[model samples]
Target: MTAHQNGTIATEVSHFLLNCFVRSPSWQLWLSLPLSLLFLLAMGANATLLVTIWLEASLHQPMYYLLSLLSLLDMVLCLTVIPKVLAIFWFDLRAISFSACFLQMFIMNCFFAMESCTFMVMAYDRYVAICHPLRYPSIITDQFVTKAAIFILARNVLFTLPIPILSSRLHYCGRNVIENCICANMSVSRLSYDDITINRLYQFALSWTLLGSDLILIFASYTLILRAMLRLKAEGAVAKALSTCGSHFILILFFSTVLLVFIFTLLVKKKVSPDVPVLLNVLHHVIPAALNPIVYGVRTQEIKQGIQRWLKKGW
Candidate 1:
């Protein structure tokens, strides 16, 4: 029996029942195969990318380090959200404990912010390499990458830790059904009977302040990079620069574009199907991960060669 049907308010709900596509069971059947395939592909590809970078001594550079960090983030994200989702799809396991839900929420928010920070750092790396070629070595050293990684972790944690904490403190009187696959912040918070004004306000402020700033800085870095490439008078300078940045550019574009779409669909949820945002949210977690290594392998010659060498050695 549900809390509403029990006559008294159950203030302490033990778990949340994730109703992934509860309105349409058919959708779960349709999505199960594709999502499983994407999850496997993401895991395999990211693992390959990480191993190739680790074994290939030639890839010991700031740029490749950041790429490996991206792959790691992708793998973490896939692991955090996909396994539970697949469980729900295949075996109807949707009972996520209260603590586990909050944990998932924290990781999702923190890692996403970290990924954005990584992209911003990558853009700066590109800017330095293209706009100030001579200073790239000194500015983007191994120590510099280490410092940037530290900053990414500290900054994102400081900013995102409050989200789950705030949500968890809310009084969940009765409802424990989450309408999405993963424990999305707002989705989980909305289940509580208490006023979520502070939660919403803080999330909005953090999203704008953190992600907005990263986007602005990434745009500025790329703008400078484009201007630098334009002024190159050498016959192959522009092409070479494009080749160097093409993979990063494409990856970031997809990342930012999908994120913006998810945000948009969320904002206009009243006008769209409820499942649209949930589906986008799920895809947002997996698609970029699946694409990252593939895109790099196709566009970046060094990584391609590294993968080839690794395969030959394995065989």
Candidate 2:
């Protein structure tokens, strides 16, 4: 494309962005401040957790290693989604080009799907630690993690790739403005002139196949873990089991609650208020990423000690 063609695209993008979410309630002005604060806190806390984990040798255990991966994913997930969202809130610039929007969707889904995979792996980790203690190392080998990570990456790529590519091909002359604070899958879908039958069907299948299967496995693992704990005769053994598994429990709760809201709202709610989706988006991304680090850093003794030692050394 010529510079002139590029300029035209830029102008259209600017216009689309300016008008995007313009119909949102003025209450966004009030909400954005608090959300920004939370986002900042989440970023800072998650970063500290990741740094402490990386710096400390004692946290090289399997569970902490997984937690560190989660912390990294958490931070990256927020970094991928939140700044653009904040930009939309602060500047009202939402005119993401078709290509640009698809890129965002692709990256977001990739990290998020990786996160889902991590959660399932985490549940299995807890199960092995608690129920099948002797087999933990052999079951969750280095080869297993490498294979699992590759599998997760491949699934995410396959799942979200079509949504954006299919979406980019659809022409949008009507409803130029995006209703949500950020360019979401559904929001972009809403603006399309083409029938979304295939897209919706894929969405359903991917959710049920990947997410549903993961959730089922999670429940199965947890059941075994709980049963083993109940059978434990010693308090110290229970404490150790809980110590290793406890962080995962918090993680499960955090993910199930936050992501469910977004998933349900996306699937069921039509004509959702612009601000509501934005708020959900913020919570789904920022809060979890930020909270994960803080929860682990504060609750995990080794991480706490590591942070203190670093500080002491600095001082």
Candidate 3:
């Protein structure tokens, strides 16, 4: 394309206005309060977890390394989605430049997939720890965590990179309003003048391929874990084993369930208000981020003790 042609395309797709739930001007103030609180909680919780893991030498292990990675992903996810949402709600800063929108879309897609992969890896950590306790030191090593981190980063980034690139290449022709909070794939793609069949199909396949595989592996890991726990001779042993993984399982369940519901709501958009999926998307980012560290800190003995030791040393 010539400079003129590129300029024309840029003009056609200059900015996108994001939609919000509160159409009334008076309600934005009230809405801002809770949204701000959630953002703060998500950041504060994840930051504390990361800092604790960083300072404590005892936490320098494969499992805690994975937990730190989860905290990092959650922090990035919250940062990617929430501040802009709060800006929209509070200052009505809804007009996002075309380049910024695609960048946001890329980060959101990449991080979410990475987060799901982190959960899957954590489940594998638990599985090895429980199902093959004697060999866990050999199986779940620092090298293993390093490989898993690289895999999560590379796999998700490579697969999700095309989504925003494809979305950005479409001709807009002046209808640039995105009817959602974040730059969701379908929501942004539908604004284009071009047919988005391939975009839609790719998104569907990507969602299922990454998340579906993770969910299946997570389920299988937990199943083997439960079976192993059931075979323990002592009742206390069974209880302890369940307690170790219960928090992670709950967080994974909530994370995957909310996301799956959001995807279904996307399919049935005709029946539900757009606000439903928007709110779900917003909560989907913050809720698990805020809860993951808390659940693990309270339930996982090592993390609980680590937090206690860190607190004893002062903040």
For this target, which candidate reaches the highest TM-score against the unseen true structure? 1
Our model 2 lands, by Cα RMSD against the true structure, at 4.4
lDDT, candidate 2, 1-315, per-residue tens? 111332353222322342334565465577678778877887788777777777888766667777777877888777777777667778766667666667877777677777888899889888987888799889877677777677777877877788678766655643467766555676677775568877778767876787788899998998888889889998688788888778778977888898788767766668675456566776787777777877777788888999998778779
Write model 3 residue lDDT over 1-315, tens digit each, in one string: 212344564346568998766554454667678878888988998888898889889889998899899999999989988999899987889999888899999999999999999999999999988888899999999999999999999999999999999999887766778888889888999987678999999998998999899999998999899889888997599888888788888889779888889889979989997577788888898888888888888877777787789899896
Off by over 4 Å in 1: 1-8
Residue pairs clashing in model 3 are: none
Backbone-clash count (model 2): 3
In candidate 1 the C-alpha lDDT for residue 243 amounts to: 86
**Each prediction's TM-score against the native?**
0.97, 0.87, 0.93
Considering only N, C-alpha and C atoms within 3 Å, which residue pairs clash in candidate 2? 17-94, 17-95, 42-290
**Candidate lDDT (C-alpha), each:** 0.93, 0.73, 0.87
lDDT of 3 at 263: 83
lDDT score, candidate 3, position 126: 95
- Per-residue error (Å), model 2, residue 198: 0.7
